[model samples]
Structures are given as structure tokens and as C-alpha cells.
Target: MVENKASAPGKGSLLQQTRLVCGLTLFTFVFFHFLNHALGNISLSAMNWGQDIRYVVSGKRLFPWIFYTAMILHSGLGLWKLAQRRTLKMPVWEATQIILALLIPYVLIKHIFVTRGAGELYGSNISYQHELTALWPNDALWQSALLIVVWSHGCIGLHYWLRIKRWYRRVQTPLLGVAITLPLLALTGWISAARRLELSGNQKLNVTAEQKSNLLEIVSQVQLGVYALIALVLLTLVTKYALGMFQQRISVTYLDQKTVKSVPGPTLLEISRMKGVPHMSICGGRARCSTCRTLILSGEASLSGPSKTEAQVLKRIGASANVRLACQIRPMTDIVVRPLMGHGKKMQAPGLSDRYRWGVEQPVVVMFIDLRGFTSLSEGKLPFDIVFILNRYVDGVVKTVNRNNGMVDKIMGDGVMALFAVESDMSSGARDALACIQAVSKELEKVNEDLAAHLAAPLRIAIGLHGGTAILGRIGLDGQSGVASGLTALGDVVNVASRLEGVAKEENVLAAVSMDLITAAGITPAQNLTERSVAIRGRSGPISVICLDETAIVLADFKPAS
Candidate 1:
């Protein structure tokens, strides 16, 4: 019940930060390299111009050193990550990027050694003309394959990095344009440069027969080394899987109902896939998207602190210590977790699992309204009369809440818990909560007139309103919502609002409003308002409750008074 006291951002493990920096730098270099190829689409001569322009933009040896360093560091770290991974169960895009990155050094090593090595070993400058002559007709397929590998790898990495940003939505269209256009342009340029050099018949790299033989030997050794590296990787994966079979399996309980069994080899997200458990994951199990986050209820001991990437994700979601990304959580022991989303689905939603809807966290205004003294007043009334009066109260609360775009969360005997801002802004929720209270007050006044003979006095209600983040969902849990399920929320903020309603009688006020709701609504509290530091249960500190009189209510604009 205690809230997560947000402290300064904890310094997460440095591995992911270093990986991101390294990957970003390599991606920048790859982008420029692709752009250079794209220039060939204009002309082989244009391609030469692009090379000059590139040099001018990225000054001399300084840029080259940084580029090569980043490339080596990124590649090395990637292999390290590949080796350290507890599980290979990942999203398709993430898997694609890893596969391409690993294959890059193998597919690309021969070409680099042939071109750059010529200058170093043979003391000969390899020009664009020679490159074109060699690759045009004979090795065109190789060139295309390398291009596909590197470009796709870079694209997927950039997408994962940028798509999480707040500004990504604004630039989504422009990014899409480049994503579709660059590949086409780069391929055209590569072919054009090669074709032009072959037609001109000006491509040749002169060397002695002994030098050629040495080059052939070097190439063969490099090729064999690549084979060895790939074989090593395969050996490692098989060993891990084989050992895992003999290792211990663990059980994870989802809520209190479903239990999934796994061999501690795959992550919770991966286990969900294996067991056919429906879970919400927008970014495939990649840490880039935090949708696969789950709340740990009774198994904190079984889980460890998150990895650097998972820490970053949790920070982005404003998640507490109890929450973790299901994709990143691989428990060594039995655990209990609850999927926070996948409830209250509408028929119009997308994806294969259209049956369940996604839940969301948002600022909502919670208003609890209690019919004052209705329980005592109903004691001597006829059974039908009590039912009639309760029905009237329920009708008023429902109509007022619905008209203001709010939903009645629950109705117990003599009170109602209503929620606002499930699909709207927090400010709107605040305004609507106040409006509903006012409307219900008017409705009760009419009810008093209609039942003047049957009732001893006019009906009065006590309302308490507070606003903050609430997790909105639709589920039938603990018999809270009826047999036919309905939308609901559970949070300390809502509990505080309900508690305030219970204390309204002690304070001798009709309605109690928290300053948070007033601030969110941008409303000015009246000068005549009664201020009290009311201690509410589940709250760490006392809330400043402001009670408004009838006159103050009519004139109040939700703005604070000077």
C-alpha cells in the first residue's frame, strides 16, 4: 500500500548505455556509407562527387579513427551480449538484427581485405573504377547480399532506439519515407557504379603473381576462421540448451489461477509464447517497448534487479521496484506475477487477440458520493419505499456520471464510487467530477420535492474528490463488478477519495475536495472555504481538504482564489 517514493534516477548498470553509444556511432557511419552508395544512382561521376563531399563533411583521419573504433567496439560488445544471453527467445526484428550483425563480419571480411588490404599489403590504391569492374557482373550478387545485411541491421537498430522517443510520433511519416527510399536508391547506385566502370574498361589493379597467391592464402585463412567462429557459436547454443534440459525447471503463477512451467531457459515473455498465455507486448519482447511489463505480487525473492536495458525501460514507464519487463525477467525459482494489461477489450481493437482490450495508466478524478443518513432513514420505511428511494439515488448518480463522460465504478447500499478520465484528459475528469456532483445535488433537490410526503427531509449527499494516476481495466474480480463484467480501477488515489467520503460526516461538510483535484482542474478555491488537514488511511501524510459552501460552489470556476 505504500507508494514508490521517486528518487533521483538510479545509476543503472553501464553495459546498456555503453552498448547504445557504440551502436549509435556505428549506425551513423553505416548511414553515411549507404548515402554514398545512394549517390551512384545519380551517376558514377556523382558517386565520386559524393565521396569528396563526404570527406569535406567528415574531416580527415580524426573521423576515420572514431568510425573504426566504434565499429570494432560495437561488434565486440554484440558478440559478448550474444554469449551472455540467458535466453535467445526474442522478437522477430531483434532476432533479425542479431543474425545480420553476426553474419556481417563473415560476409564483409573478404571484401574489406581485398580493397583496404590492397593499399596496405600491395602498396596499391583501390579506386571506385576497380571496385565497379570487380563487382559489376561477376560479384554483383555478393555486393547486394552485403548491402542487405548491413542496411537491414542498421535500420532495425535505429528503429528500436528512436521509436521509444516522445518525438518519434511527430517524425514517424518522415522516417518512413527514408526507410522506404534509401534501400532502393542505394541498390540502384551500387549497380550503376559497377556498370559504368565495366563499360568504360578502366578498372584494373596491377600486382605480381606471388602477391596474388599470398592474397589468395590470406583470404582462405580468413574464410576458415569465419567458419570456426560460426561453429563455436553453434556449439555454445547447443551446449546451453542441452545443459538446460538437465537443469531445473520452474513454475510461475499468473495471479491465482493459471500456472506456467518452464526450464529457466527462456524469459517470462518467451514462456508466455511457449505456453500460449495471452500477454500484451507491443515491441515484441524487446526492451525498447515496455508493454510487456508485469507486476510481481508474491515472488520478489525469486527475482533479481533488472538488467541495464530493463532498468531503462522501467524508468521510462515510471515503474516501481515491484514491476519488471516480462521479456527481461528470467526467474531461477518459482514466482508469481500479474499481467497489468489485456482487459476490457472492445470489438474494434486490432491484433490477433481481439477478445481482450489493453489497460492503461492515466490521471483520473475519483469521486465518492454517499447518501447522508440513508441507512438510518430507511429502517422504518416500507420495503418497497426503501427500494424506491435507493433506485432514485442510483438513477441520479448514473445519469449525472454518464452525461459528464464518467463511469460509475461501484454502488454500495447508500454510496457510489464514480471514475472519470479513463479516455479523456485529467483536467476534463476534474471538471466533469465537479459537474456530476452539482448535477446530482440538483437531482436530489427534485427528488425531495417529489417525495415530500414520504420523506422527512430533503436528501443530502457527501462527496469527496481526488485526482491522480489510476490503472483502468475491465474484469470480474473478487465479485466486485457483477456477473457481466464492467470497467474498474484499483489504486491508492481512488482509495483516498473513498476514504475522504467516509470522513465527510466527521468534518460536517457536504463535499470535500483535495487540492490535487483543484489544481488539475485549474479551479480557484473560494475565499470562504474551510481548510483542514485530514488524515486519510493508506496515505503517508494528511491531505489538505477544502470544503465549499453552496454559494462558493455556484461561483467557483475550479481556479484558485488570490
Candidate 2:
């Protein structure tokens, strides 16, 4: 069920490669960061290699500037994108990612200033061990924070990429298990370093009593600052949540403009619920339900990618790379999307694309064929039997209409509304009208033969054909499709054709008539000997119509003007 849209450069296109690159870049950064942190526990030497690599880039003097510049630009661009969308209604996983992203810069600044700048400018001579000893109690908070951010963000991006590849679901969990377990190992290594520092008290060098006291005070102040910062961030989050409750909760708008607005910090399901959108959140937004799916139309770069939950579910659904659960995508920017099911809806809210608009032309013939005595057949038959017969009859009629280049626009029980393209020069509307009548009569005759005596006798059909410049357009209820007409039909041509077919039941004939335009278009009745004036509905005077019966009308009946 994949739909391919034209991807050539156009005014409104869905593809944007830069976003993909940005997302990939961020994910790569996180993955490497976590892998290095995890290595610290293996041995001080392994940790040294990780630091050596960082030093190669961050301390290269000439290249360090370039590295710093790139990081600033990439991180800035990612943050700027996240800020543009005014809505805060993101899934829980996404909201957490954004919070962690904001914290990363601040946390990393302390790290850089202490290790690199403090040692260079103040002559503190801070090695990784020196900094750990000075920081005291050797708390692993920074280590834990950094590890969580790197693993979660990296795995999310990987999950998203894997979803698009074949067999993503089959191996996603085992892969996820590795991603999760590695970080825990890294955390354990950091904890081990803290324990070793306690055991090796001799590692600390002699210092004055005053110097030691001052260091303890400095560490206490920094710890207090960190806790205060965490408290403030929590307060801000609570305030945002409360405000979201009062205002129309943040909603995500799709390319279709169908909104999924819900509580300020809604799970994907809640958002879908608030907006009356049909989202298949099979896992209940627990990342367990891959059914609440979405294909990101934009801002994929700003996203952190699928979380562990999303990855598992996407694997279950066998989704494409771009496809993800609605629960998984917490856009920091506006996105356009087409729900696989809701693409062709009627009366879509503003800015939503209604691709279902069928642009039919005017001055065409409209024909309606009703089966006589179909009601009686339904009265005695079972529901299934009635549907079976109805389907058979409708299929036969639809095939007949389509064979002649006419559209079987709608079917109501045993009735069918077919439209012939008046703008088409290949065939005249009159000829199409006549062909429709012949096709229906012929199809019913075949059906009567096959059914023999089991059917409700032989079905009789009455066809009403109206040919004029009729507006052939959709006539449907709200959010549905239908076929209908407007009033102006050059004279009573359509009315007469309809009335003529009405008399068909009594006359026991399948009849067709020609209008001035039909005749002008090279379509003439088989026997257009005379025009008889007949009274028609909604007209003040009698209308003259050309009647064609019994004989087959040929294209020769109409001749080109010399």
C-alpha cells in the first residue's frame, strides 16, 4: 500500500535532504560520546585513549578552532529548529530529549572550563584524576547525565534509520539490548573509578590545611549551584504543563491540515484523540503500538529519532525508514503529513490538501438506470442474498459504463449514475447516452439467462439520459463523494431525455434522444424522421426532441459539414 508522489523539484515538495543530514550528524555525535564514556570503566588506559582522541581534535590548536566552530553551528541550528514551532505538545520521549539537549551545553561548559581553561589560565594543572579528586566524594552525576543523553539520543536516531530498512523489526530489539546494556556498563565503570579513588588514598598529594578547606567549600558551592539549576528547570516544566492545560493544548498539524491537538504534553494517542484524527496507536503510544504511524514531511533533522519503544513497534509494522509512529515524533518544528487512510477526505480543514477533488467537465450527459422490481427481490431474500445480487447487478452495470469511456460515478442499490465527458471530442454525448442504454439492457439479458428461474424473474431496467451542458461534478454528503447536477440545460433537452426514459417502462423500449449539440457533434438518431413536441417537467412550453429507437445509430448518421 505504498503511494508514490512526484519528487521532482516543485513549488511544494516533500523531500529535504539537509534535514536528513542534520539528524544523522547529531545521532553520530551522541553515539561516539557514549561509546567513549563506557570505555572509561574497562581501564584507565582505555579511558586515556578516548581522551587522547578528544585532545587530538579539541587541542590541535589550529584544527580545534574549526572543530569548535562546526559544533557550535550544528548545535545552534538544531536548537533553532526546535524553537520555531510554537507548540510544546510533544510526546514524553521527545520532550525529555529537548530538555536534555538544553542541559548539555551548560553541563559541557563546566567540564571544558575546569579541565582546559582552568588548567591553562589559573595554573591548576588539572588532569582527569586531579579534577576527580578535587571535585570530592567523586559523585558520578555528570557521568550518569552524559551517558544517558548519549545512548538514548543515539539509539533513537538508529531506530529511525533501521525502521526504513528491510527486516528492521526482526533484529531491532537485540540491537536495542546492546545499546542499553553498553551504557550501563559505562556507568558501572565510572562508579568503579570512584571506588578506586577511595581505596587509593595515597594518590592525593600533600597540601596545606587551608588549601584543603577552601577546596571543600568550592565543591559544596558547585553542588548547590547544580541542584538549584535542576530545581529551576523542574519549575519551568511544571509551569509549562499547567499553562498547556488551560490553553488549547499543543497540537501537531499534518500536510493535510488535520490536527492532532491534545493535552499540552500529550502522548501520541491523546493528541490524536483531541483532534478527531484516526491514528493507529496500537501500542497505546508506549512505542509498543507501531500502528499510530506517521511519515515525517519535514524537520526530521531536529528530531532525536525513534526511542527504544518506537523502534520495537516500527519493526513490528515493517515500516519504511521515513515511517514512524505518531507517538514517536515530537516535532520541534512544523511538519506536513498524509495519514495513509485520511488522504482523500472531503471538507478537510483549511491548509489541508483535499486530493479527492475530481475535476469533471460540464455540458455532459448524465444517465441513471434503475432496476424495476428490485425491491420485491430484497423483501423475501436474506441480507447476504440481497447484497450478493446487488453486487452482481452493480458490477455488471459499472463494467458496461466504463467500457464506453463513461464514468459510473455512483451506485444506489440497483441505480447507477454515469457521466459522459462532454468536453471529449472522441464521441458525442448522445452516442454515449445511447451506448449506456444498450449496455445496461444487454447486461441484464445475460444475467437473466444465467439465473434462469432462481432469480426474481427477469430484471427490467429503466434508463433516463439527459444530454446538455450539464455540470458533471461531485454530489455527495459532508466528507463523502456523490454525483449531482445544476439547472441550466440548453432548452429542455435533458428534461426530455429523462422524461423519455420515464415512458420507457410503459413503452417497453430502451430509447435515446439527440439534442442540437449532440447532432452538431456528429451524433444522429437511427431514425430521426421528425421532431415531436412533448410537454416536459419545469417548462412553460412544449419541447421538441429527436427520438432514436429500434435501429442502431452509427457514426455515419452524423456527417461532417462540407
Candidate 3:
């Protein structure tokens, strides 16, 4: 049996959480900055008032430290992530984000130095009036350009981050509406504010030649700092790659002895990329999605299990035992595995899709039908005849069940455990079950006549029906899904129905049904439906059941050889 267990909490999630928090912090700054820009729709003075409030929030001693720290850390981690990636080929949104992220530091460093760094480092009070005079006449084109670049990058990041959530799709339309409207408002306000400043003639040109040179020096230094950061990241990556080439390259054996060699500790996905293998990863190996799950064909005890983050992703898709995600796992030992979901296949949760549900209590009409005298009839027949007779009986039973909107859950030897109301309510389940028996009644009349020579006697069947709540789900040892998964109902309802069928065989009745089914179906029992109290096995007391006599629904009267 394959066992899929939920992994322990708080494993291998710190980096992801850190990135998310830092990203949100940076996104928040851009959002509020745009809002401050939007305040220009009222007036330039209003925009300055809003900008002052922004300053109160972010220009304070602690806030500036935090803001800059978040920016630098976020940028550094992003560069590190980019450097660590095995493949540049990815989804369009991911590629777009990476490109925009690279552009942000390059374009925004100059502005950051002037607006935030100038005030702190050089005692330049870069207030709204000072900034507006500088931006409107000096660098209005660059300011507008940076606004578009920053807003697009921020919006894409926010959308991608939130889209993974289940509720994201529910409100995606309205959320997209707000995403579009905010940036438009911001741009409109920025243009309006710049226009007002450009038109006003009373602008004080406060900065001297020395101060301007100092500002130019600061911007150049900031640009150099950005270049230095990128150079450091690239150099580190090259060094790591150079070291990795010599660092004990180990080949992990996959199915058919296909080997992908890489550093011993990187993920299987990393190795696959190193070997140019097309492994499926919808979320670009972030472990945010489980498109890269693999089933371990061997090395269960030898391989280390999944971390909590990998386990959590596996758990959501109902993955079974021996299945591990390729993204989060860093294999140390050579192991054999096969990918669960392949490239170009529409991926969902691997182990179980939405085809069936289980472990829930729901009322259902369970009908057990057993064919009697099969052994006696087939005693002198050839093996093929016996198999053919059994198949005919099963076929007839299945046809009748389907015609009545019932499902044949399982076949046990000469008996079939059929379920009713799988797609309907309890009352409809009872109605369907009744119609099934009547359908079987008519089917038996033709089957016995058709196979009369193969039989020593007529076919006899006892059907039992009971309706109540049962715990239903798919159970199986096969995790590939539905191959061995069997629909089962484990409750007193199924047990009582089985016992009732036994009573039917003993008392020579055509069918037996509990009072519960009769009342639920709103069927009035006929004169032939006699009430009886039968002591059932495993139950404390005798239960009231209605039995239909064989004479009322005898079915078979023809014989081919007679």
C-alpha cells in the first residue's frame, strides 16, 4: 500500500518566506509612491502634502534603514537566484520579471541617490519643491520612464505572487482592474504635477554649482555601486561554476540507467538541466507548484525523504508514498526515479485528480446481488462454458444496473455489490435501486432462456437493498490512480445489506429491502411485500425488513433442451 503522509511544518521554507516579505515591502513602497503621485490630481500643493506624509513614513531614521535594507537585500537575493538557475528558458512572465528586475537597479539607482541618499549623505534637503524643480526642467523624461518601468515590474510581481493562491482567481478580475487603474492615475498625476511646475515662473533655483556637482558625483557613485553589485554576483557565479566543474561530479542513475551528472547535492532538476533533459516544472522550479514530481522506482530506504516544503506541495496533490518533488529535493546518493508528470501534458495533482472523492459520510442505497446454483449448473460443462456463463450473468447484471442509473461498485465471485445514488440524493438513490431490481427481474427472464443448455437448472438471484449513511472513498494499493482504486462503503448500511442478502437466499425470497429504503423512496409495499423481523449477524437486535417472494417475481421459465 502506498502511504502519502503530510510533512512536518516549517521545513525548508525560510528563504521563500523571506523573499516574499522583502518583495512585499518593496512593492508597498512603489504602491504608496504611486498614490502620492496620484495626489497631484488635486493640486501640486496636495501632492506635496501627500509626499510629506510619505516622507513621515519612509524618511524617518528607522524607516529609511528598513526600506533601503529591504531594497538591497531583495535585489541581492534576486541576483543570486538568477545566477543559481540552471536554465534561462522559462515562462514569459518569469522572463519578463527577471528582465525588469535587472533594469530596476540600473535605472533607479540615480534617482535613489538624489532623493534619499542626497538628503542623508550631503545634507541636501530634497523636498517636493526642490525635487519638482529638478525633475520638471532637468530630467522629466527619465522620471516618467522610470515610473513606467517600476510600475510594470511591481504589478507583474504582485500578480504572479498572488495568482498561486486559490482565492486569487475568484477576485482576479477586480484585482486586475485595480492594478490597471492605479498606475494610470499615477502617471496622469505625475504628468500634471510636472506640467504645473514647468508652467510656474516663481520657481526658486536654490542649488549652487557646488551642490549640483555634488549631486552629480552622488548619482555617478550610485551607478557605480549598482555595477559593482552586478559584477560581484556574476563573478561569484563564475567562480562557483568553475569550482563545480571540478567538485566531484556524481552521476545519478534514472530509469533504463539514464545518467545525469551534476554536483552531488543539487536537486534532480538541476542535474536534468545540466544534461539538457526536458523536465516539466510549471512554476520554474520554485517548489510553488508540483509539476516536477517523480516516483521512486527503487532506493526507498537509501534516499532521504522530502522536506516539509516539498511534503506540503506533495500533500496538496494527494501524492502517494515514494513520490518526491524534484524542486525541493537535493539528492546526495545515486537513486532511480521516474517523473510522475511529463512535459507537454496538462499537469494537475499527480496521485489523485478530481474524478472521485472519499472518506465522507453520505447516504447511499447499497444493493448486493448474488447468483445461486452457478456451481451446480456448471459442474458438467467445459471450462469455457463455465466462464462464458459467468460472464453472461455479470454482463446482464451490469446492464440492468446501468439502465437504472446505478453503479456496479465491485464484483465478488458470483455476487456484485452495486451502489445507487452516486450522483443523486438519498431518495433518488432508493428510487434507482428499486428500478434496478425491476430491471434485473426483466433481464433474468431472457438470460436463462438464452443459456438454457449450459445450465442444469435456472439461475437464481437474491437482491438486498438498504439505505443509510456510509463512508465512501477510493481505496487501493496502486498510486498511479484508479487502476486498483475501488469504490467502497464501510458502514452498518453495507453490512446490513449483506446480511439481508443472506437472509434472502435462506428464505427463498426474490429480493429483500429494509424499511428505511421503503420509507425513503416513498414506496408503498404491495401485498406480496411481507414484513418480517430477521436477526442479523453482528447486530444486537432483529431488524424489520420487507421481503418479496420468488413467486411474485420468478423471472425464468424457459429451458432450451427440455
lDDT (10s digit) by residue, model 1, range 169-262 = 4467888798778877888888987777778777675546676567767888987886687667767877877897787788888884589777
Give stretches of model 2 more than 4 Å off. Answer: 1-33, 53-67, 123-126, 134-138, 167-171, 202-276, 279-339, 342-562
Could you estimate the TM-score for every candidate?
0.59, 0.37, 0.57
Stretches of model 3 off by over 4 angstroms after superposition: 1-12, 55-62, 86-89, 122-124, 242-265, 274-278, 299-305, 311-321, 343-562
For each of the candidates, the C-alpha root-mean-square deviation to the true structure, in angstroms, is 8.9, 19.0, 12.8
Candidate 2 on 126-159: residue-level lDDT in tens? Answer: 5546545543354357746866775676565456
| CA lDDT of every candidate | 0.72, 0.54, 0.72
lDDT by residue for model 3 over 314-427, one digit each (tens)?
786678988887876676666777876543232334422222322334577899999876767668788898788889888999989988889888998789999986667676
List the pairs of residues colliding in candidate 3: 358-473
lDDT value for model 2? 0.54
**Which numbered prediction scores highest in TM-score against the true structure?**
1
Error of 2 at 339 (Å): 4.3
